[model samples]
Target: MQTIGKIASVGAVAVAAAFSLTACGGDDTAAQPAAAPPAPSSSAAQAAQPEGRECTADDVKTTGNFGQAPTITIPDDCDPPKKLITKDLVAGTGSGAKAGQQLSMNYTLVTWSDKQKLDSSFDRGEPFSLHLGAGEVIPGWDQGLVGIKQGGRRLLIIPPDLGYGQGGNGIKANETLVFVTDAVAVPTDKS
Candidate 1:
C-alpha cells in the first residue's frame, strides 16, 4: 500500500489527478471539529441503539460484502439527520485508522432524498485515497471514519452540514448523503 504522499511525491500530474478523483474535496482550511460526536448504531434490522438523533443509518438497508461496492437503499420517507451517523456493518481486525494517515477505500455514494447513485470508486475500478482529516474530503468523512480499521465496512448518513453544504457537482442543495464505505487499506511505507 502506498500513501498519497508517496504517490504525489513521484509526479505533479498524479497529484492533480488524485485530488480531483473524488467528490469529497474541500478547502484545506475546512474546520475540524474538536471531537467526533457519539454515533451508536444497530446491526440487526434497525434494532435499538441510541436515541435523540434525528436520523440513523441503521434503517437504511444495504446488500453487498466488504471490499466491494454496496447497493444502498434509503427509505423513501427517511428524514435527513441533523447530525452525522455511522454504523460499522462489518468490523475489521487491524490497527484503527487515525487522522493524517493515508487511507484507500472503495465507496458508493447515494442521495438520501431521491435514492439516486451519486458516485463510486468501485465503479471506476480504482480505490480512492486521501490524507485523513486534512479537509481533502467532506467533514462527515473526516470525522466519521476516524477509528475504522482496515477491511471494515461502515455506513455513513451525512446531513447537509457535513455533506455538500449547499450542494455541488450534481447534488442539490441541502441534500442528505448516504455512503457505504469499505476501509480497504491504510497505506504504510513498510507495506
Candidate 2:
C-alpha cells in the first residue's frame, strides 16, 4: 500500500496548480488482470429511488459513485462536489493500458474529504506520462482512464474500492480519492 508521504508514485513529485479538468480512457489487449469497473453513466448512475439525495442530470452525469462509498457523499449543503476516480471515460477491450500509447497530463490529486493535495507531477512543469488504464498505478487510474480525447480535462472522485480500498498505504485509508487531470495526447494507433 502507498502512504501519503511515502512517494506513492512519480506523482509523488506532483504538486498543485489545481484549477480545472483533464480526462482519460482505455484500449485493447490488456496485459494484466482487470479490476472492477466504475459506475454507469448518465441518469443510470444516480437514481431518485430512495428519494433523498435529489440528483439533477448534471449530478447524475458524474462518474463517481458517491452513494456506494461511505467515505464520499453528496452534501445537501454545497453545490455537488466533484466526483473522483469513478469514470469509465472510454470502453475497454481488455484489462490494461495499450503498450505504446503515451499520456501527457497535468493533474492535482487530493483527498475527497478535506481536499488536501497528495501528489502532483504538474508542479514539475513538464506533464507526466503513464500507460492508460494500466495497473502501474492505483485502481482509480486504471478504472477512470478511458473514453478521453487528447487535450481534455475531467475531474475524478476515486472511491477506496477503486483506490487503496480498506487498507490504504498511509494517509488514505477507507478514504475517497480525487483527481483533476488534463489529457494531452494519445496515439491514434499503437499498432
User: Which candidate ranks first by TM-score, i.e. highest?
Assistant: 1
lDDT per prediction? 0.65, 0.42
- lDDT per residue, candidate 1, 1-191, as tens digits? 12222222222232221212243333332222223323535442253322444556777899999977799987644456788889999998677788899888788888775578867878877787777876566667778888888889999887877666544345555667888889889754343
lDDT of 2 by residue, 28-123 (tens): 211221243345465533531244442332342323321111121243323322234344333323223344355665555665444456555455
In angstroms, give how far residue 168 of model 2 lies from its true place: 4.8
For model 1, state the Cα shift of residue 191 in Å: 16
Q: Which ten residues in a row have the lowest lDDT in candidate 1?
A: 1-10
Q: How many clashing pairs per prediction, in order?
A: 0, 27
Off by over 4 Å in 2: 1-100, 167-170
Q: Which candidate comes out best when scored by lDDT? A: 1
Instruction: Quote the positional error of residue 42 for candidate 2 in Å.
Output: 37
